[model samples]
Target: MTATHRTYPLDESVDAVIIGTGAGGSPLLWRLAQAGLHVVALEAGRAWSDPSADFATDEVAQSKLYWLDERLSGGDQPTAFGANNSGIGVGGSTLHYGAYVPRADPRDLRLHSLQGVAVDWPLDYADLTRYYQEVETFLGVSGPSPYPWDPARSYPLPPIALNTAAHIMRRGCDTLGIKTSPAPIAALSQPYLATGSEHRHPCVHRGYCHQGCRNGAKASMDVTYLPAAVAAGAEIRPQSFVTGIERDPQGRITAVLYDRNGITERQRCNAVFLCAGAIETPRQLLLWQAADSTLPLNDAVGRNFMAHVSTQVWATFPQPTYLYRGFPSTLITEDLMRPDDADFAGGYLIQSYGILPIMWAEQVARSRPLLGQSLVDYLMQYPHVSGLGINGETLPNADNRVTLSSEKDARGLPKPHITLTLGENEERIHLHADPTLRAILTAAGGADLWISRRTAHTIGTCRMGTHAKNSVVGPYGRSWDIPNLYIADNSVFPTSLAANPALTIMALALRTADHFLQQR
Candidate 1:
């Protein structure tokens, strides 16, 4: 069956109905469709638009992709490390991500077995290696497959040539007896394979990736997986917000009710896959539970929230580094990422590079005085500034979970009330990682280093486990109590990995898609 614009009645039924179209939903969309299973993916955000059609010209389009109101006030709350938020749109947060995708550390996969901290995943790194490779190939990843830095796999493409900032950082790491390599990125450096009839082009180094790459060089789901899924017969509905799930007495999902702005409609389906991400996914589950507590309820449905507690170390240099001339992240240091660290309890992966003067100036404007010559001098020498961000693992805490607030959005649904704070272990990870990052900056002739310890990479609300009592989803990411109800988002993560969650989320989605395909 070929995909066509679907009407509200949905004259035909689908084998699987996926909600959310970002990291987790994208790959699953393609897998289920390719497996010949009827799939319909619902996206709350609008489809990607040309730069001209975007409303707020600057960084607003990137940040507000998910239809977040410019007046939205709750996203900038304080956290265990720093300020963090999420984007909502047709591609979900992937449209706004930094495009730096690294595989989950093998050590990360064995966290439970090694430390006895969280419950062990029913699956491990080896089980997902093949799927990771498939995802890497699909995304056209570029980087070295060295022993210490990468776990092991042939990169689909060569790493991007290092810029001056990257070269300087690499030299500093070499001097410190630490390994620094080109971070595996999803951006096209040289060229990419032309899959199907789509013509993939190489990156032009516009440095405007987060603004929804106009050149189609970035491997966002919009350009990669979603298009593949569409070609394979997957129906995608944008701007459709799923408000409720209608389940039968047998605990199987029957229909998904949604609203487009204000009008309401429903569609019947055999299975429902919730990939709305950590905060929204758990919030939806909790909402469903509140509506009917007897529906295969798990106390852990909204528990065990976790993410990388990140901190940024900014510095002023003597010369212009052209930091924003290319991709924001091209280099990294894993020296401080380890299970056992004395100074910091949590592990951090240090990255160098990001945004430009206008953005950094805005950030500094919020603080550090915006008055006379001081601010003017700061803006004048902005190109000479460089920074290192510490992306580190965080411990899961039941208390640091997402809950529905008394307040509601425009749709009258409860707003996301996140009660999260950094755990002791996470604080330790940053403490250990920052100084090593600072040393690298110092060695590179950096001064006036400013350290910021906050992050927005949220994860692990509806985690997977062997037993229904312990987790919401099962080994294959299906809801343990309700076979038809599946979770394909970051909510399935038990522990935050040492690296970014986006790549691992895609791998999990691939695994889930394979599971569903095998069932057919």
Candidate 2:
């Protein structure tokens, strides 16, 4: 369905006021509005009015899709925030996300119950199993049928064809007796009509998934849920940044205060869904808490932050690997998802990776001291380089939190000060992954290895759990302090599941919306 561009009165109380129309907010808005509730989504940035026409494949040009707002960072490893993690605009980070939509393993959700480390999620995989299928179907996720994982299911769309790099990775995995499968991604492998006549075409494999898909195939929320929500009678107010939430004396949220075109307006609502993402979600809460001295202290609001151990091991192969020609994650292996010999408490996933020219060069320059002819010659070998990446689970650290920074932004709102450091489990996983990835590539006739340390998919700042005292929100995403408020984004993830977070966030968001509807 195309956008109806619905509008709602500011002072008139609506059924729900959703902040940020990304993966979380968009899905819920579509659901609530389709169910005949008055819903409005307030986005901090402009909507991709026509994504196919507006989106460009150029990496720097597509930077507008990212949330580049000022965010203070400090820790043993200060986290990278912008395009690598969060996005603004109507689609949120889904705009520039790599679109690798892996489902969380049952072990990913119940890590605490299985290994006695990291708190288990309030709801386990069983609770989210159906939602996973729903999200996959809605996104038209392309993957191998009979997914080779626990609690497996067939995909709605066929797997995207593997590129040269994936072939080499598969060869190595095959020789090493390790299982490999085509990675699941939200990008369509075939033409699909997800909602109404919104026809999504198959991916052309331009391999610019990180730079935002110029075609209407990646299933970014802008191309799917946001417009569907608008068509379903939801009001999408772009450039409206929510700064404060108002509540009654009984601790029930009543209205949302936001700035749209420099004018502050109070949007009265019976309930609010905060889906601004990991950094902004907690930042909004902390900012609200800072202004109100009477509000009870909730140290748990920004505690236990986590970023997956995103380490990429790149190798130059004798044969052309064509790293720039396919989806970044074309192939995956769960062989190490639960390794018995690992010192780390949890496991990690290995994926055959792709990289564009500029980002690859940046990594090369950051990792090595090659200069002049040496640098040019090494860079010239780009087509022969293949990469294997690790998306490892991270145990939460209370000290790894998002605190209010003294710095203020253009809107004078307190910036989110994100402090995150790798714990022992993550460190050990990195150590294991580095050698393992090197071995896999080497077995496939690769050499000149370089490993880049990184993190992606920020999560768990406003974690969901069984109780409010120890967690930021309840299992259904309702806040314990504010009865009518819910957090339906990555911020509500209890742990950083050892996979990309977009699919799970969508699943959790749908579940939260379903629960909200069930209660109504």
Candidate 3:
């Protein structure tokens, strides 16, 4: 179904107001609307109504889809290319994500109990098993059946076809005695017949998944949940920038203020959900606190910012691998994700990945002093390049955080200052994983290899926990101070799991929506 782009009056009231129609808000919006609640979803960016026409396979042109807002970066390992990792449109970052949908290991939930490092999640994997299955089914995820990790259920569709790059990685893994499996992804391997009016075709293997799927095969929120929400009578307002939230004397959130085009508007709502992502959610909360001094600000609101510690190893093979033909990631190994006697508290996931020429050039520029002919020479042999990377679990450090910067954006709100430093544990994990990746590429008959350290996924800004002092939200995503306010995003994660965060974020959103429905 085509989403209804409706404009409501400034003073209009609804049962729920959701900020940012991304992976987090979109699912909750659909659930609430299906539960008979009037919901309004506010998006900060423009909606891509016609992705086939609007999106381009050209890497330089596709860079416009990223979130390029001013965000200052600091620390020993600052995220120099922050915008490249996130998106700015209606579907949020999911618009540009590779659609990897690996589930977090059950051990990930009990970090504090088992490893004695970070705080444990209020609920375990058992609490989200049903919701994970529900979200996977709704998104039509494709994966190998009888997963070795013991997932609660099987995937709805068959696994995506592995490319030559994945085949090379699998051979290397076999030689090294490492366990390998087909990577689970949200992109459809077959045509998905929607329950509503929306329909999604099979992936064309265009190798442009990160530029927003032009064929509607990717399960981005715009094509899936957002449209379904609108079909269920939910209103989605694009380019609506939420500034601050208001609460009554009883400490119940009553309204949300936002900027639409050039006008400031206020919308009254019975409940408010903040899903503006890790950086923006805390920034908005800080703005709210600045406006209302009486509101209690959680000290941990933006304290523990965590992004995955990623290091890529690009290898050039003798033959043309055509690595960019299919999905970017097709094979994965979690053998090193958790070792019984590892020095590090957490682990990492190594997977086969393919990069476009422009993206490869940009990554090279960011990491080293290569430029001009040096980079051009590397790009000259694009067809022979095959890549793999380790998405290592990062521990939440109190010092690595997002704070309100003195500089402001066009909307007169303070820009978010992000500081990310690789902890000792992460460094150790990377040191081990980097060599392992190098060895795999070597075994795959790779001649030249390039390694670069980078940041991948973001999490743990508004962490949820059992206590009020250490966490921003409770187990159900309810704010500790404001009863009617909820946070449904990766920001509420207490621990950074060694997996892509999209699936977990969706499951958590569905669980939070169910909790809200029960309360109502």
lDDT digits (tens) for residues 197-310 of candidate 3: 377899998999988899989999989998888888888888899877777889888888888998877899989999988888888888888888888877998988998988
RMSD for all candidates, in order, please.
3.1, 1.6, 1.6
Worst 10 residues of 1 by lDDT: 69-78
lDDT for 82 (candidate 3): 41
Pairs that collide in candidate 3 are: 1-198
Give the lDDT of residue 64 in candidate 3: 71
Off by over 4 Å in 2: 195-197, 371-373
* TM-score for each candidate, following the candidate numbering: 0.92, 0.97, 0.97
Backbone clashes counted, model 2? 0
Candidate 1, residues 1-520: lDDT per residue as tens digits? Answer: 1235333346456788899999999899888888877888888877865533553435543556643522222333344211144667767777767778877777776666776665566796787888878888888887777625656566788887666667667767777888888888887876687454245688777666666666667787877888788888788888888888888878888888887766776778988899988888887887787777787767888787775777777778888888667777888777666734454433678777766556567656654655789879877778888877777877777776777787877777787766567766777777776787788888888898767656658788899888888788888898887778889989899878778888888999999877877775
* Candidate 3, poorest ten consecutive residues by summed lDDT: 1-10
lDDT of residue 9 for candidate 2: 94
Per-residue C-alpha lDDT of model 2 across residues 75-177, encoded as one tens digit per residue: 9977788867889887888888888888887887888888899889998677788998888888889999898885358999999989887898899888888
